[model samples]
Target: MDFTPGPQGQFPGAEAAPRSAPPNFIPEAPQMESRTFGAPGRPGVPVSPQFGFVRPGQIRRCIHRYTFIWLVNGNSFWFYPTFVGNQFVQGFRWRRNRWEFERINLRRILFFRCF
Candidate 1:
């Protein structure tokens, strides 16, 4: 904004200040579409590691069911779910001869395959 002094060269005297132009936003920020399991996506989007599995459901049905989960941090695990909640899942992870109990955030898992 450009301000011009009035008669006595005082501030806010007579003439109003010029309006500044609106910021140009189109070039500064780019737009992208969210991707599905097999397609390309942004940073936090989960990726499906293998084929033959459909989208996992609300987690309640996973009791005693074997599952493959890929997390946002690029690590994947085979887990057996025991409980399910809106934002988290409690389960046992498969390892060398044992299933260890763990509680995990649903948001951290990129894609979950239930079988």
Candidate 2:
């Protein structure tokens, strides 16, 4: 029993019909001019100067064997141990060129471990 339709059995009037253009058509590419925010002709909004804290030859020291240092907020530094299949023990924060000991909150730390 063949269930396939023959030539006249498909979409009754769509055979070899002419296709219309797509619903949306653009004749030419839109023009876009590159301009800076505070340029001469553009509105001058006071843009805050962007700068980085770590200088070219800045020296960073990691206190512990399994710890690493990260520059925070481009000013202060944060030192934390690399998690190795266990809960984090302790961390440190360096601010104003001084190292300060920071205790890890066990509750928040455990929450992340469970999830």
Candidate 3:
């Protein structure tokens, strides 16, 4: 029995398999991406220069990985900014002699410097 629907677009019957693929199925696998944030921008930019942290829009513009991130818990580290989403910034952190991926919320950043 042909499972594909005809021009009428009516199901053959309930006993046969579904005419369409499962909802979770995809036609093609997602491709891995390699992105370059471009040449290093002006470093030493302050994250919270006055009273607030920089918004995602400003961080998105600086994609270079030289930004110094200081979390709200007094933990500070320097990492390469890879992807900046609406609420979070994703990047690779140097750990154990290897680049480990890390994500941080834009709001949790207390101090940000790009030096």
- Write down the RMSD of all candidates, one decimal each: 24.9, 30.2, 19.5
Q: Mind giving the per-residue lDDT tens digits that candidate 3 earns over 2-97?
A: 446555553322122223222222122122234312212323334322323557777775475366666656676655676677767766654554
TM-score of 3: 0.51
TM for every model, in the order presented, reads: 0.51, 0.22, 0.51
RMSD of 1: 24.9
lDDT of 2 by residue, 37-87 (tens): 443322432222231122212111221322222222122223332212122
Model 1 clash pairs are 46-110
Q: Which ranges of candidate 1 are over 4 A from the true structure?
A: 1-57
User: Candidate 3, which segments miss by more than 4 Å at Cα?
Assistant: 1-51
**Deviation from native of the Cα of residue 98 in model 2, angstroms:** 0.6
Candidate no. 2 TM-score: 0.22
